[model samples]
Target chain A: MSTAKDTAGEDMPWDEVTPEAARKLLVAAVEAFAEQGYHATTTRDIAGRAGMSPAALYIHYKTKEELLHRISRIGHEKALEVLSGAAGIEGTPSERLAEAVSSFVRWHAGRHNTARVVQYELDALSDEHRTEIVELRRRSDAVVREILREGVESGEFDVPDVPGTTLAVLSLCIDVARWFNTQGRRTPDEVGALYADLVLRMVTAQK
Target chain B: MSTAKDTAGEDMPWDEVTPEAARKLLVAAVEAFAEQGYHATTTRDIAGRAGMSPAALYIHYKTKEELLHRISRIGHEKALEVLSGAAGIEGTPSERLAEAVSSFVRWHAGRHNTARVVQYELDALSDEHRTEIVELRRRSDAVVREILREGVESGEFDVPDVPGTTLAVLSLCIDVARWFNTQGRRTPDEVGALYADLVLRMVTAQK
Candidate 1:
């Protein structure tokens, strides 16, 4: 679940995306969309990035929106997988929440280019696709909320509002993708550690 | 400093911008940029929205990029003013920090359409324009950092990483523009209050 190493290696986080050409198209589309945004990036530009012809792009995906939908779906699935992995880890709620936040932050920082497009370009997706993506986001919300709820029930966390705090926590972690820079002082691991510590501080029992 | 009422009435946050036609163009640009993104919004579209001819747009602003630069500059100034106002309030570090986050969050949520364009369309700015906006952003950061630094010095807050926490706090407030909806369950004031509480919890001294 650690995406830290993927930032510097050929072992990309998109390994699960099958059919090499389709994955290539998807990867190219992510770059195009990130750089030029969805409305300005043409299908031709995505095809050119993939070293394929526009005809070839059509062979795989019908429209640019489809490429974005695929990226959004796949990205959300990976995000959910990472959160669920940490949530199920054997530990106290504090430990679990820390793990959840650190791993989640790691993904957002390390894969920021792709994460930016996945998280920000939702308005460009077709309504049907967006509905599906929204459901996945709700699941992500549920995962974090459950952790806070468990901590509160166990008297380990002093959250006044579980749902509201959950949104704040998730929003804090998610915004990392918007500002994370490779040339910045902190590495992904450092940010993940700092954020996890801060998040734990947010929920720790006040005493 | 309270922007909570701006979401519902005629008193707009963009009143600082002038003349009436230029202000109309800026307002139109914000709407167009928010709905279709920076790269996709045409000069003609902006002029049309302002009920002006495309040639009239060129008369007021040399190019579309210039229009964006003006919006960004104004928006950043407003954000800095909001942060500075909260920072100067006579209170403890905790009170100042809470006010800063709550007011900052309110602006993002209340004036979200402009905030959305201001915060998200940054990459589309010319390098010089972006640099100017980035400098304004640094000032905003300094205000938050000073609050946290004072809190640490006063032993009222237990922040180990002032800069990192400042980034998280600002990022959390700024992202309200990304997801804030008028039709949503929580009003701008409610979100601002909730975020302020959560942020205080993040920095409050641990037992």
Candidate 2:
């Protein structure tokens, strides 16, 4: 239920996707795909939502799939950026992991629409497109895995299965998009903090 | 990727949704909705998949939404049964919570196809139908919340926000349907065990 603008202010994700019309189409596509799902949406619906004709839609993206691909590519890149930024920060692995989860969860909750389409609509993409997106996702996973691995190495955390735990962390954050609502009781920040605390508990070593 | 038969054994969730023909249509509808989503799947497709005529579908259910509602209702009841069974077991709060998460997660992963349709297609239901389904979900939430409340009251758990943690635990388990693949490295049992361990860590008091 977040207005597109709610997620568009400073550090906006889609600012780099061009031209302006193409970005509009991409934004509209995200909205449509999130609301009705990828299989039920059409290129004409994206074009209409963007205040353009169907023909004009083709001028920027030839097919609805292309639009989805672009949106997915950009969205994944943003997600990777959020995780990589936290992973690279100068802090203990626990601190880094908390930051990574909190920020990643915030993005999913704040941009629930775009995150929903990016996280749930992978099957709608062509094989080639899906492969590219999956690669981006792998990098995101690696960032979290590295944090968990470092924590275990440093004896700062007690994760028994780093890979499985990494998947759970990412899966936990990604699903915030499915249930988050702008009108919900918890704000994005609140949920982010709560999840971060819970995640930290999952990894913290018992004294 | 699981076959319908894989989840239709002795403890099949839909056995109670008779008659035989109606159950077939419901199973077929779950497949169609899981594969193509609710908006994109037609009743004709459900009928064909069930080896029945369109008229047969009409005789059993007036509309596609009716099929979805029945599936949702039955699926939710099964989910509630899983959680409530775990909650009612004679064990410590920690043991019960672990049992609840493991079994609930197992159901979501082992029956991913039906779980996908039941969890994700709620938005497509009619308002009245959605409200009914939502009420069922509230009961599911209540079951989990009661367990967490007991854990907190018994001083066996370190939960700061019982209601919020309940949502996180339920959200984590429900999402297994979205990412769980039959061909994936982890089996339903393994994933359930891993998740149960992780969730236990999330609530156990630090020594």
Candidate 3:
């Protein structure tokens, strides 16, 4: 197996560095964290999973905590990125809401392991780190809430409690990771489309 | 500093044990498992929290896995028990469903720690143990699905997808343990009532 030191010779410059290396590292970290949880996962495990030595792993990230923090941040950021893009598309409130839900389900399905780490491992971080990740989570939640709030305000949805509805929608999407797996019957796209329909029905006003 | 032997000297029979003792042990196990995860928690840790030693702990349960299994089995049984009881009451499908949701929320709120362990720790079990627990979970889920299916058949609920709606409802309720702490602003009763209302609205046909 190539050691982390072996990869050091091929390290690209900052601007030229592809996310391929970091992405592979993050993917391995997510599987380790999800399987063994945050506190149990060692840097060596992540390094081994990524097919690199511990020293080579350190070339990409400083500590096990740092690796967790980076994966969580990236997962949150990617989710926000997708939601923000969804929010920009022009459509009726119901239509836009459906699109946003679809985006969330798709993102979650594609990155279920990373999503699990982001959702469950926040407590393993230090106070400052936990706060930072919580804020990121809040922002992602707020994006979904904003879309639902807009739907409710526009009379397209009739939620009795805005906060509860927001939580319901987000929870439905988030919990998909707990059960969704390749071993299951439905493909990610199928689940995503079905979820989008269900969510839309959940929030939309009865005709 | 008392051992489990000292603790079980009291005349609390297994069948007639006080809810207080069971609750105490369950709470201690929850905190230990939550902090250390299931694999890392020793019987001593749970006994330590319950102010007893391992021998006393074993009086109520044969093994650590048995304790964990009972905690989960009891939680699921209580929820199913509530649902079964609620189903016998005379009401519209919507009303009964709301009552079922209320019962679920109350059960989870009252036993949040046990709920957390039951929801999150199955993966740590041996394959045979995990399968048994999974079956229990599926049976519990089926009770909810039966209620929803009855509603659909009676034309009292307007959910688009029966299985998907069942999942959404269960997901919303189960995720409460992830964030519902006693320190939060809302009381458990208040949260339960609010969630019950949300579920009713989500599934009920408009007047």
Candidate 4:
């Protein structure tokens, strides 16, 4: 539920970096950040989880903030790519939008620990880093907005406020990280499929 | 936008805490908890925000956890009351559900800083306290579930899974706290109205 799962059935196209030690540190950092939150997590905790001395963390990442920046940048970049990938696939607007939501929701629910840290810990980033991340976030929004626009234009969906509905869809997906429990009855795929169907209902209003 | 204001257009039924000092401390705590999160925020920091000594905080509700408990309890209790109030009203199922979503979303948007802490920072509480708080949360879910069940039973709504739709509806409303910004375009009332319409579409599937 937390780390290192195959992207089968889900559309998580994240990469594992080279230099096994650094990847270990990054993975450890994600767990720490998810469990204790960004502000409360310490460099020592990350280092200890990675089986290294405190000073060892500085060799790869200068500060705890840098670790967060790296994780966020990569996470958001991959998330944007996932959205765009689904959006660009050959299909009707509804099909593409459903694909996007299914995969996007799956990523958030399946890899929710990393997603939780990525989504909620933006404030801990310095301004420069945050601006970069926010730009990625905006692009992610544009992907969804463009799909909604296409749906409306094609008469497949009847969204009155495309931008507002875009935000609502993304909000609904992002919140899976906050509330999705592995112990719960539904699997990530089940939740993702349900959300995809529900989102289509949101746009088309099928009774 | 973050603090006190008239609930004229917005249907926020929350009452401001009585006793000026307690209110001040609660407001300060909400700001601190919202900014730094519960684990990173200390009692001293919360007291300082209220312009009180560290010891002065003890005169008001004991430890930092107590402050969070008080805030969370009151907020959830009010939220439950809001939902049940709207549900208990004499109206069609759609009307009552819309009223519930509108007022509940309004409360979350208008008082989002407090809501952000109450919704997102639950893991910071002690085990005993969290158990108590979780019961309130279940009650909140029950209110919405009951309404959805009524809607489904009446053949007014087309939801296949009442429990799943209930979770989605609540998730949509709860996450307004995470994303709603005062500097953004819509007011709380507007957002509430929009969400009410959307929730109606979600249930009724009316274009």
In order of appearance, the predictions have TM-scores of 0.94, 0.95, 0.83, 0.91
Query: Taking the tens digit of each residue's C-alpha lDDT, what string does model 2 give over A42-69?
Result: 8888889989999999999888889889
Taking the tens digit of each residue's C-alpha lDDT, what string does model 3 give over A114-139? Answer: 67778878877778787888898788
Tens-place lDDT per residue, model 4, B1-207, is 323453222222334665677777877887888887787788889899989999888887688888898888888888888778887899988999999998898878877877888998898888998998899989888888888888888888888877888899999999998888877899888888888877787777343
Second chain TM-score per prediction? 0.94, 0.93, 0.79, 0.89
Interface DockQ of each model? 0.79, 0.79, 0.37, 0.57
Instruction: Provide the lDDT at B202 for model 4.
Output: 77
Report how far residue A87 has shifted in candidate 4, in Å. 2.1
Candidate 3 lDDT score at position B29: 75
Off by over 4 Å in 3: A1-23, B1-26, B47-64
TM-score of chain A of each: 0.94, 0.94, 0.85, 0.92
Clashes of each: 0, 0, 5, 0
Chain A TM-score from candidate 4: 0.92
**Models ranked on lDDT:** 1, 2, 4, 3
lDDT of 2 by residue, B83-133 (tens): 899878999998898899999999998788888888888899999999998
**What lDDT would candidate 4 get against the real structure?**
0.83
What's the lDDT for residue B41 in model 3? 77
Candidate 2 chain A lDDT trough over 10 residues, lowest sum = A1-10
| Tens-digit lDDT string for candidate 1 (A1-207) | 224233223124576776888888887888888777888899999999989999999999999999999999999999899999999999999999999999999988878877888988999998999999999999999999999999999999999889888988888888888888888999889999999998898889977
